[model samples]
Target: MPVTSVEKDLNTLSMTIVADFASPLQRLWDAYADPRQISKFWGPVEWPATFVRHDMATGGRSHYYMTGPNGERSDGYWEFTAVNAPHSFEVNDGFANEDGTPNDMMPSMKMKFEFEETANGSRMTNTATFGSVEQLQQLIEMGMEEGTRSAMSQIDAVLEDLATFAAGKGTELQILSDTQVRITRVIRGTAPQVWDAHNEPELMKRWLLGPDGWTMPVCEVAQEPGEQYRQEWENTKTKERFGFEGELLESAAPYRSVTTEKMIGMEGPSTQNELTFTPVDGGTLLTLVITYPDVATRDMVLATGMTDGMETSYLRLENEVLASAE
Candidate 1:
């Protein structure tokens, strides 16, 4: 875990937070630059953030929102003032509506982030300036200090995920055929560990759930060819449940597996999934290819935002499952 310290200056109407992470400066910089990575740690653990739009260049704008445990959402936007890759950036940050319109009633602030290489890892300092002492007090009263500190503490976890995805691995989302889509990621773990994470019910329960407030109530896996597997997840608060069950078409321990998937509530054709795991320098390169019956069906699944869900799930797999293996 990282150490985050916040200092508030009422006279200057400013707050500065400094944190040291046991990760390389470039890794930390990349995490902030990538919107998907930003979503992993931009908020506290309980309230996760989802980035709707991200443009990391000078004069560009970014819009995102944080979703609370009870499904409440808080929207915000950032207008980039300057961007120095792997070093620093400046932004005007403030609250926004669902349509990304700036909220006039909210106080806007200027934020600057600086990253420096340290002996063990990297050091980052964030300085935020408010218009007046009253405005600063208003934000502090809204739990900004505690929220920011809690968010900063998750940087190490995000850094681990970024490192896994950056290890000469490419995330390719391609339409292999009219009815097929392929997604791949080079994960950081041995072949055996990766296999366990996918095949073991206990390990699968940890990171298989896509988002924060969801839990896998039922997870059953039979790791042999012709065996059946099923997984079910529910929103703990809403009690809404959804899942899929499939039978293995091919199974090879620590290497490859193929299955036929029929989604529970989704009406359509079943999908064929093939997973290949290969040993890389320090981990395994896992490639997943899913095939549908027709282009329209594939497009329909894509419209359901499966890519983002899978990406987030894989990130959790790296941070929680693979990191634990080490």
Candidate 2:
């Protein structure tokens, strides 16, 4: 996750993980195949995870990404290998284009998952082989496996919770929580310009929201607590409007604004939104995070194509932010 503009001076560890769970082979297989199932145990409990497209079949291809607790992103490709169901499958994977063409520059690897019925339940064996021995060794030296195992433990816990939830077992959504979303992004713009792009109400309307027709109707934002922002979201094609009344959770001028969003006609747990700006050469790196209180609500928002909407908002912000590079 991106440390907010408040923690501008602190360092955060961005980690990648892999894990296996003990469940029925078909159950394990379904988690790898279904987007909704993937969303349930996809990440660090606070963030959101959603699939872009998935084709699980022999020689078929897929692609998906995850957004961080703070709206950071990471996505990769889906390659299918040996796809006999309830048995074994493998893939040559990496961040890829919609067509499943891998990003050649990024580290790509081979992943083989094996599922077998165990006396207690089932065993899933995952092996990720990096292309180079150096890379593999490098990951090992950095304790990659340990982190992967921890994340997997989280996955296992959630799976158990899901089982309970499925069997009419619990009320609280806490039983299942995993890291959600992978992050991928970069920013380019002077710090001041970027800050303006995020904080100025009218400015945000132009690039971040769109023309007045689809833009936020009333945006009231304060860079500090006890403040509020009256922002409205409208559908460009359908004229559907969603309203958000938010209290400034935390505000650091020209750096960040964190808010608690309560959207009209939507209930459950309210959503928390945060935006941060960091100065980079010739620009400021902007990070946006959306956190949901429960996995079910998070899943619902993700299913609504919230990630795509957020991406569009960020791109617009970048265009405006970059205009002031000097």
**Candidate number of the best TM-score:** 1
Give the range where candidate 2 is weakest over 10 consecutive residues by summed lDDT.
1-10
Q: Per-residue lDDT tens digits of candidate 2, residues 113-192? A: 77777675666666676766665666567544543443354555545554532412211111122323322233456546
Residues 180-289, model 1: lDDT tens digits = 67676667787688888999888899998887899998998967788988899999999999999889998767666789999877776689897766554446656677
- The per-residue C-alpha lDDT of model 1 at residue 45 equals 80
**lDDT of model 1 at position 72:** 91
Q: Which stretches of candidate 1 lie over 4 Å from their true place?
A: 172-326
Best by lDDT: 1
